[model samples]
Target: MSVALPRIDAIRDAAARIAPHAVVTPVMRNARLDALAGAQLFFKCENLQRGGAFKFRGACNAVWSLSDDEAARGVVTHSSGNHGNALAIAASTRGIPAHVVVPEGAVKAKLEAIEQAGAVLHRCAPNTPAREAAAAEVQRQTGADLVHPYADTRVMAGQGTLVLELLNQAGDLDIIVTPVGGGGLAAGCAIAAHALDSSIQMIAAEPEGADDAAQSLAQGSRIAGITANTICDGLRTLIGESNFEALQQHGTQVVTVSDDEVVAAMKTLWRELKLVIEPSSATVFAAVLKRPEQFAGKRVGLVLTGGNVDLEALPF
Candidate 1:
């Protein structure tokens, strides 16, 4: 049988490697949001993080953990927004070249951010297979290490650092909730939260249009061939193979919200908290709106993943 699971100690080490580049973002108590969720909600405002998302934590760690030979080869990956810019920034800090493959429909602001961070960007057809194939080709061309946006162990471990910091900021949280795309952050959350307290309920919030995690959890099997059709472009993908296995084995829960609900949450965070979060980050924020009972009166944690919204691209 496979081993129990990766140790949180490894993730903690990754956190140490990335702390210099990543910010220890504040965990703000939002009374209005807490009242809506019927719980004491601590919003981890990663929207204010460097490179405009929590991906910076993982990207920085992954890049820094590279050996000198690997660093000389540089790094590469495919991402719609946060991860691409994050890797670009991380590689820039190390004076290493970075190559990023992006889908055609990727948000313009994200594309600009990646370019602004000094990464060479290559456009690909907007599909899972094409994106992966394009990224693979870039790696072959550049000999860069393929730093998968979500599936890499180093990246997942680095993402776990967020929860560790959150736990340090606020002790004894009842639950931790975050938006799940390919499961990097969710995997990190599961590893970090449960390692600290096996009782901490880690919930992943997703958009209904691309609710692969929800469907997979219910079906009890890995599901592929499903197309992502969500306005939350950051969440428009299925979980990674190992990520699905981890989620199922760990009993991680998944919740979903509509695109409209995400939009409403975005507006709420902006209006009430004055934070300009993206549609994907709002997915977890919208979770409380849908399932008020589950989080009611609990010390709940919400990871606001990013703030890379292009004002002109707002659906309103």
Candidate 2:
């Protein structure tokens, strides 16, 4: 079977479909940040979105896109945190059951949020294989559709909608950057950005510890040897196959930032913009800072992917 990647039209449709549910999150700017980065930055604040993350957009789209029978059967997926919570909340909105397989040591606050949204949680080992097995078992038992966090077409299309909204909201941007984990959001952003304006360059920020997307893009194929040991918890996964293909086709650039750099960016975001963002979200800022010459005097748009950080486990 051939792959069915996300398309621009589908992304536009996703924007329309999820409009009522997901926030049209504000685009913020700070003079201090501009001076620091030497770029006019537009921050798409998905941190303020429902579930406190952009994951809600894709999860909502997937849950709602289901046929009546599928929705009735409900949805199942595996996630470290945000996506699971988003899926649980999305299913709750449609009055459908949701089963989430989460790793044993997932974030406390996020796991609590998932449970609070009424999802039945299944615990597994913190590896991809374990999570997949647990989710498959849940789907087998419950007859729920498996909505792989970053690999599903519906999810990728839904993720593209954020860039669609950002381009409309942020005016003319010379560059757009977002953190890449499993590559759903980055791939989606690349598709939408390239479709809207081929001139706009796409960049994906990744943790140095989990630089699979960067390595994959360099090798012209997927590379999966890197064991994730990043503080950017949300960006520790290997890029999905479709996501890698999308990035390769769209000509996206991947920049790797150290965990320390991510932490510094997180602090700057809090101090300069008064926004509480997680380390994964901070990767974009780190990217810009990593290469100030590339972004200088340009209108750069950054997607603040999520803000689901544990207060007690503060890195700064």
* Candidate with maximal lDDT: 2
lDDT of 1 by residue, 1-316 (tens): 1222346997889888987777899988877777777788888999888899999988998899999999999999999879999999999989999999998989999999999999999899988789889988988887999888888888888888999999999888988999999988898879888889999988999889988889988998877756888889889878887777778766888998999999888899888888888999999879978888888788988899999988897977
**Candidate 1: which pairs clash?**
38-297
In order of appearance, the predictions have TM-scores of 0.97, 0.98
Off by over 4 Å in 1: 1-6
C-alpha RMSD in Å of predicted model 2 compared with the true structure: 1.1
Candidate 1, residue 238: how far the Cα is off, in Å: 1.0
lDDT of each: 0.87, 0.91
Clashes of each: 1, 0
Candidate 1 local Cα displacement, residue 32, angstroms: 1.9
Candidate with maximal TM-score = 2
State the displacement of the C-alpha of residue 150, model 1, in Å, after optimal TM-score superposition: 0.7
